[model samples]
Target: MNHLGDAHLRNWTLRLAALLAADTQDQLAWLGERELETKDVVEEVELLCRVSEGLAERGAFEPEDLRDLRAIGRRLGEIDATCRVGLWEYALAVDPAWDDIRSLARQFLLTRLGDWRQPLPRPVRPHTGDH
Candidate 1:
């Protein structure tokens, strides 16, 4: 891979990592600092499902990463929130029903790349090679 290709791969991992981490309150606050609101986990997790393809193509994902991803997906799938606005939006932060999702996300974030409790890179706009 050339420099640009390598950077592209790196971006995918960071984006995937961010999507996973954004589920937790700590990471949510971190994203807030960068003006990145990744709180709508229903949408973000869906985005992760697609973005992970790029990461997989680049051979950037670990075996455990896929396992953890599926675990998170399965947990979200179990939610039966009765709101058309969106499941995560329906399950507010204080809602006990949302706890499992956040806990799973926090575990995945830490297991895959350590959580926000560790130092993280300053936020960068994901590169799509387009304006």
Candidate 2:
């Protein structure tokens, strides 16, 4: 993936970790209400949530844990691209004029990636509209 896409995925991974640290009921309720733009997003979130719950129960991230998290990040990056494509399709279907709205939504999603502390390998720059 490109740099921005990779950063977004890393951001999402951090966000997932934050969610895992939060209350389970709150996380479930939040996920339940989100208007995911595609089936891939829904599936990815469910899968990640399950994994996150498991990891939380284990109490710490080991080498294998980091590997699992990296895998999740890669998968999320794939799904994120798919979701964006789906969004574009919907935009085209509804009205081409909605492109600006779609752009804003995409940016918003990127921004929502979370405020968790940076994870390993390399640091992710804060998302600040540079993309």
Candidate 3:
């Protein structure tokens, strides 16, 4: 997709994320009432809601959640590259704000998936008397 399209998608993603984080019921009502410009956009919005709901219910995203999101993203990307979802690299290249959103999403996923990179407990060092 072109730069303009990318910008619009990024805006929509941010807006949707905000709505999802704020109040899901209101967001759903808002979506139901609005007339979206395109079917692809509507599909994307619905998909976003589904993903957000799934993540919320699970308390974080699992590997399957990532896979599902990627699959949806790939399908949407076929419609327009900018429509791609769950792609951090593309998001970072297009918009700086996406970094924050992506970071939160990543943390959620990592928490659910188990963060193995955390350091193990170490023994405390004895204090020396010499000053």
Backbone clashes for every candidate come to 0, 0, 0
Candidate 2 positional error at 48, Å: 7.4
Residue 58, candidate 1: C-alpha displacement in angstroms: 3.0
Worst lDDT run of 10 residues, candidate 3, spans: 115-124
Q: How do the residues 1-131 of candidate 3 rate in per-residue lDDT, one tens digit apiece?
A: 23454445434444443432332243334445343333444365456635544453443434554554454344434444444343333333454343443344344334433431222222224456877
When sorted by lDDT, best at the front, the candidate numbers are: 1, 2, 3
Better of 1 and 3 by lDDT: 1
Please write out the lDDT profile of model 1 over residues 94-123, one tens digit for every residue. Answer: 455456655665666677767624444465
Candidate lDDT (C-alpha), each? 0.54, 0.42, 0.41
lDDT of 2 at 106: 32
Q: Which residue pairs in candidate 1 have backbone atoms (N, alpha carbon, C) closer than 3 angstroms, thus clashing? A: none
Q: Which number leads on lDDT?
A: 1
**Comparing 1 and 3 by TM-score, which wins?**
1
**Candidate 2 pairs with clashing backbones:** none
Which tens-of-lDDT digit does each residue in 10-97 have in candidate 2?
4564554544333334434445534434454435554653554444345433344444454444444444343445532342345322
By TM-score, the better pick of 2 and 3 is 2
TM-scores of the models, in the order given: 0.53, 0.28, 0.26
